[model samples]
Target: MDTADRLIESTRALLWERGYVGTSPKAILERAGAGQGSMYHHFSGKRDLALAAVRRTAQEMRESAEERLSGPGTALERVAAYLLREREVLKGCPVGGLTQDPDLMADPELRAPVDETFAWLRERIAALLSEARQDGALGPVLDPADTAAAVVAVLQGGYVLARAADSAEPFHRAVGGVLDLLGARVTD
Candidate 1:
């Protein structure tokens, strides 16, 4: 890839592997195999490059979710598909992981994409739940908005749990539990 692209990609990986506080411009340059001048020439500085990386990661997360949630199936099936989708369980959610970075969270520009991504995901999942309720695929008792929020929470929490334990089992169990709860609410 080109210099700018390499820089952004390297930053993205660094941000995922190391939080904003841990990811250094020097490390980014080393990872990208680019010179110091290349980073400055392409962007203002580390923050500028980080913002680009964050935006790209957020966009990718949204696209992947949309692909899974929008696919054909019952709403419950789609939701399950999203929850059970392959992921780097130990690495954690790229966008969700950023929320743990104080430096990143303190900067509104850096935090906006992360906030927007979760908001969009909750809304999208809510829409799916709403559709299911309307079509009698899901029970009417479950509130779409609340359940969506819970779904997002569970997924994020699963990542934390898995990371803490240094095993993917916690993540799998959490997902399976959520799926069971959702499945129980599905109408005949």
Candidate 2:
């Protein structure tokens, strides 16, 4: 990879591991094995580098979700596919998980990608729920926004709970619980 590409990828991993507050320019440069001049030559600063990483990760996630949502299926089927798709659950959703970082949230420009990513995901889930409502799949009484929040919440909260316990079981149960609420049969 080129210098800029190397910087961005290093920033992404550092941000993922150390978060915005915990990460430092030195950490990134050290991780990338790029000198100070090489990094400053590419990015305006740490924020610039982190923004690129965030945007790239967000785009990747959106593309992955879109593929699953667009695949041939009923609305419920698509929703299920999107939810139960295998993930590195312990690592958390790259975009969603970043939203909780204080330093990241403090920088409006840097935070934009995280906010936009979740906003798009919620909208997508709500739209799918709307379709499910229209198709008589989900109950009419179910509120689309509430349902969407519940779906995203399970994933986010599961990550938090799992991280707290340092185990994947909470994430599993949370996702399973949401699926159960959606009236799908839960697998063993």
Candidate 3:
């Protein structure tokens, strides 16, 4: 890839691995195999490059979710598919992990992608739940908005729990519990 693309990709990995504060320009340059001059030539500075990386990550997260959510299935099935999709559990949700980064959240520019990603996810899930409710796929008592937030919370919190326990079981259990709560069946 080109130097700029390399830089952006390297930054994206670093941000996911190290968070915004831990990802340094020197490390990004080293990872990208590009020199300081090449970095500067491609982007203004660290923040600029980080923003690009974050935006790319956010887009990727959304697209991946859309793929699963829009696939052939009932609303609950779509959501279950998303929650059960294979992931690098210990590494955490790329966008959700960023929410814990104080430095990243402090900067409006840096935080925008993270904020937008969660907002989009919540809205998409809410819409799905609404569709399910309308079709009587979901129970009458379930509120789309509240259930959406709970689902996201469980997933995000599951990551934290898994990380804390240093095992994937917690994450799986959390997902299974949420599915149980929703009375969603696991169909092939």
Candidate 4:
């Protein structure tokens, strides 16, 4: 990749892996295989590069979710697909993990993409649930807003649990539990 691309990608990985507080300009340059001149040429500094990285990560996360959430299927099926999709569970979520970084959260520019990503996800999931109810695929008793939040909570919590245990089983179980709950509400 080009210098700018490499720098952005390196920042994304570093931010995900090390968080903003832990990531340094020197480390980013080392990881990106670029020099200080290249990084400064492309970005004003670490924060600027991190913002670009965050934006790219947010876009990627949205596209990944859209692939399953917008695919042809019942709403629950689509959600299950997203939840069950292959992931590097041990590494945690690139976007969700950023929320844990106090330094990142302290910066409005750095946090905007993370905040926007979740907002978009929740809205999209709620809309999917609403559509499913309208189509008689989901039970009318389900609250789209509450259920949407629950779904996201389970996924993020699952990642935490999995990381703590050093296993992907917790993540799978969480997804399975959610699917079971939703399965009970799926209309014929």
Candidate 5:
């Protein structure tokens, strides 16, 4: 790859592993096999490079969701499709995992993509929940926004739990529990 592409790819991988603050320029240069001159030629520094990486991650995530969310299905079917999609659970959310990094979250420019990505995902899920509610698949008083946020949190948290526990069982259980909790019931 070209220097610019190499730099972006290197940053994306490193950011996923070490986070923004934890990843140093020295590590990036070595990882990319690019020299100081080569990296600086493409990016101002770590922040500039990280900003690009975060934006790239956000775009990727948005596109992936839109693919499933917009697919043919009932609200439950669509939601389940998105949730049940296989993932490398141990790797976690490339963007959401960065949210836990203090240094990354502290930088407004760096954090914007991370925040926006999650916000967009929450809104998308909320739209699906709204549809479910309208079709009487949900409680009439259900709040789509809160429910959506909870769903997002569960998936994100599931990744964390799975990663920490070093097993995908937690992730599967978490998603299944969420579906069961949100699924319609006949009880009063």
Candidate 6:
């Protein structure tokens, strides 16, 4: 990778491993194997590099979700595919993880990608649920928007629960529970 690419990738990993407050320019340089001058030459500073990283991460998250959520299957099946897709559960959601970073969250520029990602995810999931309802795959009582938010909450909260317990089991169980709930709402 080029110096700029290396820097952005390193920053992304650092941001995931360490929050914005914890990810230092020096650490970024060290991780990227780039010189101090390289970072400055490629970007203005740490924040600039971080913005690039966050944007990249957010874009990737959206793309991955779109692929699964829009893939072959009924709406419920697509949702199940998304929920059941393989993930590094212990590491947590990259964008979701950023939400815990006060320094990142306090900065609108830094937070924009994170906020936009979740909003898009919620909307996408809502659309899928609405499709399912329209097709009679789901019961009439299901609220697409509210249920979509719950689906997101369960996934995000599952990360926290799993991280807290130092086990992926909690995450799996949370996913399974949510899937069961959604399944129960399925119409015959």
Candidate 5 lDDT over residue span 1-188, tens digit each: 88888888889999888877678888888888889998888888889998988899899989988888989988877988899987889988877878888988899988999889999999999999888888877786678899899999999999989999999999999999988988753123
Q: Write the per-residue lDDT of candidate 2 for residues 1-188, one digit (tens) a residue.
A: 98899889999999889899788999999888899999889888998899999999999999999988888898878888988888887787888778878888898998888888888888899998888888777887888888998898788899889888888899989988888888752222
Which parts of model 1 are misplaced by more than 4 Å? none
In model 6, which regions exceed 4 Å deviation?
A: none
Candidates' C-alpha lDDT: 0.94, 0.86, 0.91, 0.92, 0.87, 0.95
Candidate 4 runs further than 4 Å off: none
What TM-score, over all chains together, does every model reach?
Answer: 0.95, 0.91, 0.93, 0.95, 0.91, 0.96
Please report, as a residue range, the 10-residue window in candidate 1 with the lowest summed lDDT: 179-188
Candidate 3 residue-wise lDDT at 97? 84
Q: Which candidate, 3 or 5, would have the higher TM-score against the true structure?
A: 3
Residues 74-101, candidate 4, lDDT per residue (tens digit)?
7777988898899999989989999999
State the lDDT of candidate 3 residue by residue for 105-126, as single tens digits: 9999999998899889999999
Tens digits of lDDT, candidate 1, 1-188 = 89999999999999877878899999999999999999999999999999999999999999999999999898888998999999999988988989988999999999999999999999999999999899888898999999999999999999999999999999999999988888888777
Candidate 6, residues 1-188: lDDT per residue as tens digits?
A: 89999999999999888888899999999999999999999999999999999999999999999999999999999999999999999989988999988999999999999999999999999999999999998888989999999999999999999999999999999999999998998887
Residue 58, model 6, lDDT: 96
Ten residues in sequence with the least summed lDDT for candidate 3: 179-188
Point out where model 5 deviates above 4 Å: 185-188
RMSD to truth, every model = 1.2, 3.0, 2.5, 1.2, 2.1, 1.1
Quickly count the clashes in candidate 5: 0
- Residue range with the least summed lDDT across 10 consecutive positions in model 4: 72-81
